[model samples]
Target: MAVYVGMLRLGRLCAASRGVLGARAALFRTWQEAKLQSVRPLSSREADRTSPLPIGGLSYIQGCTRIRLVSKTVGQCLDATAQRVPDREALVVLHENMRLTFAQLKEEVDKAASGLLSIGLCKGDRLGMWGPNSYAWVLMQLATAQAMELEYVLKKVGCKALVFPKQFKTQQYYDILKQICPELENAQPGALKSQRLPDLTTVISVDAPLPGTLLLDEVVAAGSTQQHLDRLRYTQQFLSCHDPINILFTSGTTGSPKGATLSHYNIVNNSNMIGERLRLHLKTAEELRVILPSPLYHCLGSVGGTMTCILHGATLILSSPIFNGKKALEAISRERGSMLYGTPTMYVDILNQPDFSSYDISSMCGGVIAGSPAPPELIRAIINKMNMKELVVAYGTTENSPVTFMNFPDDTVEQKSESVGRILPHTEAQILNMEAGTLVALNTPGELCIRGYCVMLGYWGEPQKTKEVVGQEKWYRTGDIAMMDEQGFCKIVGRFKDMIIRGGENIYPAELEDFFHTHPQVQEVQVVGVKDSRMGEEICACIRLKNGEKTTAEEIKAFCKGKIAHFKIPRYIVFVTDYPLTISGKVQKFKLREQMEQHLNL
Candidate 1:
């Protein structure tokens, strides 16, 4: 007992001398070890099934490998909202069956900061928020940013990466770290890989703490009072609008992942825009609910979906650990969900269910879908029959906080179904001629460019790559093919580079794909144009039918009758069961196109 007390006193003295104290906390290492020693260890699968978060200080270092920002960007947004709605329920994990009010969330965030500081974690640390849609995961992201200090930290946010370990153990973490960064191969133990990664000395796992990782709660308990409060103030003051907020690694199914650098302003404003579009400002809690099946690493999942729900004082209902059609509809009904927002495939997944209506979705307010050009008929089913008349069509990229354009609730049936809607109130977009930055004539389809609050900072560790996408004036080259009409409404046709030129006529897959979405038995579909001999190119449809359903090319062509022009319909149809998707849920249509071309012997 004397030895334990003596060590605690010595650690406190050392902490005081270093000026890294938060709220005085008991070092939890001894306590947790004792507690855990008493409980039987669950098998790896059972442990995973219990908690999605990694159990360590890995959250502290998740995003810090390349520190991007300086202030409490999103955290401040939460604070501002919490000031007015302190008692409002901000987060709820339906499966965990736990809810946190804004004030309660603040308290937990503060405690997390204190814990992070008690350990050697300083500013510019990488803390991974890898988990299913859960409250704790969200809290880890904000809290790490809040506790950043000028100590031995390098980066402040985790450059987004997938958790490699099926189950993490502390002893083997160094081995795991190698898997994370093969470049660290030559680095000496206990030293950073480089000065560019200053303050990126730790990896805070949000789930099971690995052998080489620091247990999260233990760090919190070990932190001194001064380090905690100083971090709180640092977070409140350090985070700013232009400061980097998130470094989302574009899912690299196509190629190597590119790090998309999002600013606090980008994310905060993105959420604000969605809230504004939906009229979701500080609404009463019970009257609002957001249901989605996307992972938080995706732009739509973070800025538009969860943050919008949090800002509006609404409850966020996470749909699944994995995409299950039955579970999605059930979550909506179980939560009496007001809003269902996700990729077009998500909706298709639900509709494919044999008994989608079995879920109690009577309380749904409507839904929003992105990821692909939504079939208008699918939109009609979600909004009209599913009773979500207020559903909207929104468009964006990871570089734009994932939202730049949106459809308004007031849009007519045709407008809502056809156009991607107008530029958001604070966002501006222009069509650029194929050559240079020339503004295209009104109603001319060309490259879509945009700039506004929601634009990201730049790409992390890839200045050349960033410059290629974003212009000198911060306008992002969206690469999307779109035409703004006389009313300033923007209709996305397809990607500029993705356009198919058959003989002389230009074919945009999205426009043609919309026609396929209306088919009754077409559960999911992607339109891609393949090279042709005389025509230069020909269109094809990679189709997925609903369960217990069948579709023929003739039947699909008939469904497109009158609804689409003759040349726009896919000449080739290949049924598929799955798609290659990015972390954000966008299909890798290019890959699909390649496969289809091979199948067709084109």
Candidate 2:
């Protein structure tokens, strides 16, 4: 997930049967008993039980469920889970051969938190965590705040401290820090005085001690004293659920990336709901092990992977510091992992591995495929080949605590492949006509808007930008063209800005991209609008072919002809090896458009 290219020793902690198959068999019986004794039945007001709106009715719905929200901070949630399942396996970094139980993980987090406090990092102070997914990364993610984009994010949020590894792959973090803050070379540990980054006062190295920086072990040791322990306890008293815990920067495809601030309340409830939907709450730690190859820095890993596992008391397995398809498969087979999280591209890479068939991935039952629009073909392939029958498609942005819609385990294959599933509980959604500024009819494409507890507080220090999308009524305009069907399933069509208007006819590129995915020769495709002198814009399809397959623009065009509307057919087709992608794996369509425009001289 962090783009490193190295092999790590495989961990064999949970490689054996471990009675997982027996525990899985007991899962349903346990769930039934739990439901009968403690769980409440679904209310009539719940979204899934309600009747569909009329065909011409407004595309608006609310997920009114009986599930109460978790009124606790992130730290509090972790603490409660550790108390309940102290001996359960909490985290396993297979590549690093590191494993920690729930109690041990909490101990590590508290030590890191105390260490941060010792270094002048207060509860509200910003601390940027920069590195790949590892044991240290997990500690920092739960112990304090996180950030990305080295210089921009540090300055934007006024980071008070930074936790980073000594070196990741080819990038030496200390060297980069020195280049950014030249005074770091001469400053005393925990007493940095810099001109470029004035707010930075401390730097903690995860690997080893460096000049002018404190070693992670040294800081951890410093926190073991009675004085530090008392201070940490006192500091925890002032923590609030509404306090911002994470500041994730947007992809910045259209503009400079803005930090979308998320509160503890937002992510805690979101993660719990996601886990409940996935039925993870029904399984014990031994019965459910999650293999996450996505970067911990991203929301998919932090909120979806890490927090969800914490809430459900499931085992979290890290296959590698960076994403390696082979390594991920090996982890799944060796650990007997039950769930796997990744983007559509990551899944493609995994399935394309030459020895993919050799791995025993049958242990996997469910996970999430998100971060971009997954073609239906890919979904079917994953279900058939990967043995992930309950695999769900999730849709959301970083601003919404990253998950708004997800498929239920019992949902039909068509629903899973075609739609992003129903709205999450406690969330309200409506499709609005961009021009009319009113709710659109069911099954009609429009800009999707969501209002919920999951909505972010606002962009960090950008009120005007926040107001531009989030209205006074609290509806966060998604800027995504989507349609809600009669059954309340939502299908994202395309980005509003990416929609092409050719001679007054609207064309959504996602539809064409989905169509092209059905082609036998195509592995992936991105359709973008190209500037045209006559019709204002024309369609350009950039496609990546399957391995060992060859095709031409004429053949691709021929495939599209007669299957779709004439105007929907691409005017220009170009074969591509890959599309420009963000670190989180979302295709940068703006960049793709720019490249095509330059190549065509348009």
Residue-level lDDT tens digits of model 2 in 384-475: 89999989999998889989988887788899999998888889899999999899988899999999999988887899999999999999
User: Candidate 1's residue-wise lDDT over 1-602, tens digit each?
Assistant: 00000001111111111111110111112111111111111111110001112123111001011112212244444555566667877666665576677666655555555554455444433333333444444444321111111121123222211111223223343354455455444543233343444333443433465533445545545443665656545544433345443455554434555556555456555665567666664335665778867655565665566556544556667666535567778887877787877778777677667786677777876557775677787777777767787788888877777776677666677888877766664566767787766777667787888876667667656779889988888778877888866666678888876788876888888876776666667777777778888898888888888778876788877878787778777778788888877545567777877888888888
At residue 76, what lDDT does model 1 achieve?
48
The candidate maximizing lDDT is: 2
lDDT of 1 at 94: 65
- Best candidate (score: TM-score): 2
TM-score of each: 0.78, 0.91
In model 2, what lDDT does residue 346 have? Answer: 96
10 residues in a row with least lDDT, candidate 2: 5-14
